[model samples]
Target: MSAGSHTNEIPRHRVLAKVEGPLKPGYETILTPDALLFLADLERRFGRARRNMLEYRQDRQERFDYGELPDFLPETAHIRNAMWEVAPIPPALRDRRVEITGPVDRKMMINALNSGAKMFMADFEDANSPSWANIIEGQINMYDFARDQLSYTDTARGKDYKLNDEIATMLVRPRGWHLEEAHITVDGRPMSASLCDFGLHIFHNGKILAEKGIGPFYYLPKLESHKEARLWNDVFNFAQTFIG
Candidate 1:
């Protein structure tokens, strides 16, 4: 016998239920088909929040912001201005135009920068062991050079630009996904051998730079097309939103 009705028949109605997680950190909502049905139930029981979801989104992002991410993503906004001179990278700078190799020292770089060559490439591919230490060192060395003393800097960059100056553009062709025999040794022993995606490194580092109110420098090489540029832009945008 039924409790509500003294009949063997059942009523034709949809059964619904809602479940909430225990109040704690790291609780994620399971949004299965069943979970959606439960959401409908919750709408019936507790009702929805008054604020429009989009309005709350930005606020939520702000709350989630650790203030560690950069404030602006870097992008080359080509605006034709009379005061500033515009020059496309020399044709020689394009992929396959210049050959690069070996562990480079500051003197060699200074020579390249001083040379009147339209393009100078610092190769991470053939040159030097691409261990993390080397990468960091290369970056520091690349970044520390006095641009004003360098030809590219004197012409494109201001005369005052010095080593460690946040001005001037430099091109670095980082070692690709080629694994070497000698792995990047960290802490003492060799930690691991792997490919370093310099593209990603440049993107994140560029943002780190931009967040510090500095302009990023670097000519991207071996690009297939606009895709790499778009990736760069996206990384920059993401970096800008958080790097504070």
Candidate 2:
């Protein structure tokens, strides 16, 4: 079937591996048929490059263990020497004097977003334990937040939480290149956790954030080389085109 053909079911043209763990209720809300197809398309488009880069990382690690030091790539010296600066910062991110980050649990999500800080990164990597429940629930929290409907009720504390009218500008940090989401798979291989985190969040929130005059901003982690950065940039470019 064509990519757009399977709207409410898994696409037959792709070979998706079975999820390896128990899927909790409400997971279907985030891992819908269309979302899976989007992920499958990403894997088909970029999986080989991702695998090759991972292999390169392993080879580099072996060489490092054998006492080979690293150096600049002679091939890209001109690009490196060229003068450059990033585009102007987005309006919401301009006053980045204070920023906070934490995992995407209910309490943390409420606190971090409501914190007086200028920005809050809903971390899906270092601060997160990467359990299946955590990943899917994080996505849900982000989806709700984008729509200005996220809230938390703390019966234990006899308190309720809701977003402040003026809260921190939100950002997301996906899992590193080294991690794989064991719970999600495509083509009989574990899906790239980075892709899963980045894709799901962006698919759900990009347009909404854009409409709000903010961003679906991202904080990428554990990039060991310029190549990895380039890979992320490519993904960002593709995502912009795809989302648009």
Candidate 3:
């Protein structure tokens, strides 16, 4: 990447963002200027640490492949010995006995939201195709889902899909920290898929969902270390401060 990679293509008034993938019709709604700015902000704030974390994962994997056995780290003995308590579970999340999960396809998301499970996990990582259209349209679906106005028409089957009167609590599962969202780039580097997933949904719908008693719940997958988890915690804190 060149020093002027981002500046060369992006307008001065807008955040430095390069859309490498095809932006189909209506994708602009989800990839708005404000939302891309939010993503770029996240990338600027934590992108380096995220890259380091991925590099650490690779190093650990290589060591394991070379016959290095797993053992407790002496440096983290205090953490292992310390007695710690987690924050109290929120009332809305106390009873997550069952959660149904699927890709973030429009109709599938509607069906998952209306499923009888206690929670619906709209997965963007494992269960998704990760095509540009799938990812962007999924964001659109999430925005509408949070607003409780998500609907889909099966024109061929002549059927419509919508949320039920009583629906499950919703949770988003972003792509792992290891993944890169190749569609959009900040500073000529592809944005972290994790940030892209969490940033877009939270930037667009965090407050909307909060007003409905759900505080932008998420299920982070494939975290390998405390530092990786710490990165997410920092992202959450920064996002709250950014969007407050």
Candidate 4:
């Protein structure tokens, strides 16, 4: 085999057992117990499924994979650091893959982490009371988990973290610059509900992640074209230099 090539088949692990949750209104149950058993047997004929992160690493190396993306910034790979103080990500993300879900602030975050997802963005900007205090508190709760996994420190903005036991693939979505009105109160009171999962996870290189030396955020909606992406990247890069 040539370098970076392997012919051996990797071991497979079945998710195994039956797990069920409630069906939402109007949705039909597609598989019965007998059907599930049959499907398992049918899968046995093929093989177990093993996830391989290296597959993704290989694609990234070959320039064969990326998110819904476009052209990259100059010296994109030559990036000195993730440089949240400089920028979180570039237009490269438009060419890479992006996954979206609500900010998991409560212990529900623990469930999402255990479910095998690769990344989590605890949402303060768009998932909690839009009050600055609430946003800061929710972020603290997330750092409760972060502190166990990595060494992080930033007391100025009241952000510090360390990590342990699956620190969680995570990012954070701040209130979208355009959509803060979606949750921010007019009288400056906390929102009756809270921010929904609508904003992108934009980090201005807070004292938390700056302590850890890692940075990235999921670009949320309103990003309609590459020019817009370039603009967002520039904004993040500029913001992170001081905050990050």
Query: Largest TM-score belongs to which candidate?
Result: 3
Clashes in candidate 2: how many? 0
Report the error of model 2 at residue 146, Å.
0.4
The lDDT, on a scale of 0 to 1, for candidate 4 is 0.39
Per-residue alpha-carbon lDDT of candidate 3 for residues 1-244, written as tens digits (9 for 90 to 100): 8786553565633575578898788888888878888888899889999998889999999999999998898999998899999999887798899989999999988888777999988899899999888899999999888877799999999999988898888889999998999889998899999999999999999998888888699999998888899899999999999898
Estimate candidate 3's alpha-carbon lDDT, on a 0 to 1 scale.
Answer: 0.89
Evaluate all candidate structures by whole-model CA lDDT and list the values in order.
Answer: 0.39, 0.85, 0.89, 0.39
Ranking by lDDT: 3, 2, 4, 1
Query: What TM-score does structure 3 among the candidates reach?
Result: 0.90
Tens digits of per-residue lDDT for model 1 on 38-69? Answer: 32332232221212322354554576585644
> Alpha carbon lDDT of residue 40, candidate 2?
72
lDDT of 4 by residue, 79-170 (tens): 64565464454342332243444554544555554544455556655455565345443544454443443244556877644333543455
The Cα error of candidate 2 at residue 54, in Å, is: 1.7
Candidate 4, residue 56: the lDDT equals 39
Candidate 1 residues lying further than 4 Å off, grouped into runs, are 1-104, 146-169, 177-215, 219-233
* Alpha-carbon deviation at 183 in model 4, angstroms: 9.0
How far residue 57's Cα lies from its native spot in candidate 4, in Å, is 36
Which consecutive 10 residues in model 1 have the weakest lDDT in total? 186-195
Shift in Å, residue 115, candidate 2: 1.7
**Superior candidate under TM-score, 1 versus 3:** 3
